[model samples]
Target: MAEKIRLKVKCHACGYVMEGTSKYGKGNYHPEGLDFQFTAVGKLVDKAGNSRVKGEVTILCPNCETRNRFDI
Candidate 1:
């Protein structure tokens, strides 16, 4: 059985809160609360021709439509 972890994030612009759950090994992560969207920004290419996304992410807040950026 995999472990379940609780996740929470706060909006820096409006003080809104969001919650979610993720499985340790299953990689089934889902967020619940105000409607929001996230996009992975920036990319890095390795010498092996493999591309990996950066840890930085841009989140659009549904409450105020403010775009918040953070490094995860």
Candidate 2:
């Protein structure tokens, strides 16, 4: 069975919830902040426990902190 996960990012300016799909990517990403692009690849394992290039990652965001929040 495949596991489930979720990522929650809050806006610094307005605390707007920035939710995204959490596809399993190894290690910590954006530790230094969201001022750059992040790429990572991990080893894959089959049902029989074999090894392969798992996948890669790309974080796409608006990076617009100024307008991330809205008033009700």
Candidate 3:
């Protein structure tokens, strides 16, 4: 099963708020955040079955339309 994570981003240049979602596993995608495109791959799993995700996401400012790089 894939886990769905919701994200909210604020534009640094114009201060626009965007909401989006990223899904883990199952190769399914639903565009939630309107201002950014994020792609995360690989997983870090613990002994207890818990996992930590690491990925790079880019934030697109609506006003300025600038792409900002971030790690999550």
Per-model TM-score, in order, reads 0.42, 0.29, 0.65
Tens digits of per-residue lDDT for model 1, 1-72 = 444434367779898775654333333334444333333445568999965444444567768877776664
Winner by TM-score between candidate 2 and candidate 1: 1
- Candidate 3: lDDT of 16? 75
Q: Candidate 3 on 1-72: residue-level lDDT in tens? A: 777767766766777776677666666555654635657767779999998666677877667877766667
Total clashing residue pairs per candidate? 0, 0, 3
* Candidate 2 wrong stretches, greater than 4 Å: 1-4, 25-72
Each model's lDDT comes to: 0.54, 0.41, 0.69
| Best-to-worst ranking by TM-score | 3, 1, 2
TM-score of 1: 0.42
Kindly report which residue stretches of model 1 are placed more than 4 angstroms away from their true locations once superposed.
Answer: 1-7, 20-54
Highest-TM-score candidate: 3
Off by over 4 Å in 3: 33-35
Superposed by TM-score, candidate 1 places the C-alpha of residue 59 at a distance from the truth, in angstroms, of 0.6
Candidate 2, 2-62: lDDT as tens digits: 2223344566655555555432334543333333233344555789996543433333345
Candidate 2 structure lDDT: 0.41
TM-score of 2: 0.29
Cα displacement (Å) at residue 23, model 3: 2.2
